[model samples]
Target: MTYQDKVILITGASSGIGKELALLLAAEKARIILSARNEAHLLEVQAQCLSLTPHCHVLPMDITDERQVQEGAASAIAIYGRIDVLINNAGVTQRSKLIDTSPAAIRKLMEVNFFGPMMLTTALLPQFKAQQQGQIVVISSMAGLFGYPWRSGYNAAKHALQGYFETLQTEQPIPGLSTTIICPGRIHTDITYSAITGDGSAYGAMDPGQAHGIPVDVCARKIVKAMRNKKKLVLIARMEKVLLWMKRYFPPLFYFIARKGN
Candidate 1:
């Protein structure tokens, strides 16, 4: 479907895949609403989108905050009277193993990566129902499909996202609403820099795997294509695709290779 004049709300639109999506969608002449905790960065992204299209608004929000999420959902609907799409792209990663990671750290990851998206989606459900049509895109991770080293909380959170959204798809609470779950492997972004450690502190380092992975723009393009197709599920990866196959067909070899992965 054409994006021209479509109202799309994207969370975490300040940078990475979200920023690229905003720019790309803006170029398509879609009305864009950007949301994230960093108002300054949101404004920067808004300015960039404004250069491409006339319809761009910034809604600063911390998804983890239930009150803010409720307000943000209402404000987003008010901006364009109705939202055609909601991209749940805001999330955090974990850099600590299960043995060393604190319970609080795991909870923090859950709050942002799982509960936040669920809350926002729930808040916007009525709006989608009122419109009688909407699209929900969730940016999960390869970790959701399988476990990996040094990412216990991240894995759990993404897995939770998979379960929740997949169930939503099956339930079909909104008749004309559709859900797209995207599993991306090691996209070249600075997500690792904000990764939480065992003590819930930022890892503050770029991951070698992420640095060598698919480009952020490429990832965004694939996501948009999947959304337009109304795809049920999409996997954007290289070797991780093989790893998933191995996990399904040969568990032992998958474990051995996954252990050696970075």
Candidate 2:
């Protein structure tokens, strides 16, 4: 559970939960490697990390690019000699009704939300296996737990990660290797604004659910604790926590309730 001296790499570190996590972990004395597509935003995050702690570095790269993901992983290993934690937090969302969803829109979501993380994890798996000790943390959504209206592609991608990572855990049971899949209900972030719209533009709006879900700082702390404790699955949010349990025990009722969720 000790974070001191551990090397942690986080994608989507440019802003929101990822940036908050970087700052928190840096303050805990963990060596941090921040990666995202925006060099400018990455630098800003790196600066903030430096202000909090000196053990922080930036490796800006587009997660959607396999080569960049590989290079970024190499850079992290080169910096700290090894990676103790890899947080797959980079993802994009889209809000569109199923009937209106286009092939292109779904592909875009898959590229960033599903394929990007899959590629990044695949690139890191070798090192983790060789060491027999590493943590892979995935930032999924409650949408992954159940289908949500107006986010067909988004839900599918997250659901895919949950399936793949969970199976990866059973298929490759490396001693000391750990995977934690996080399903967050909502939070006040720019995620909605950045979410792809039906017309292929940013949504540029906020959802009330996200506005009142949880604070980013609180969520970051919970995530760090879960990672350090090596939790296999962690669901965060007041109402979503209940839904998580329901989905496991009362499938029929869970489906009915989920159908009623907005």
**Superposition-based RMSD of candidate 1 using all C-alpha atoms, in angstroms:** 0.7
Off by over 4 Å in 1: none
Off by over 4 Å in 2: 244-262
Poorest stretch of ten by lDDT in candidate 1: 253-262
lDDT of 1 by residue, 191-217 (tens): 999999999999999998889999999
Cα lDDT over the full model 1: 0.95
lDDT of each: 0.95, 0.87
Span of ten consecutive residues with least summed lDDT in model 2: 253-262
The C-alpha TM-scores of every prediction are 0.99, 0.93
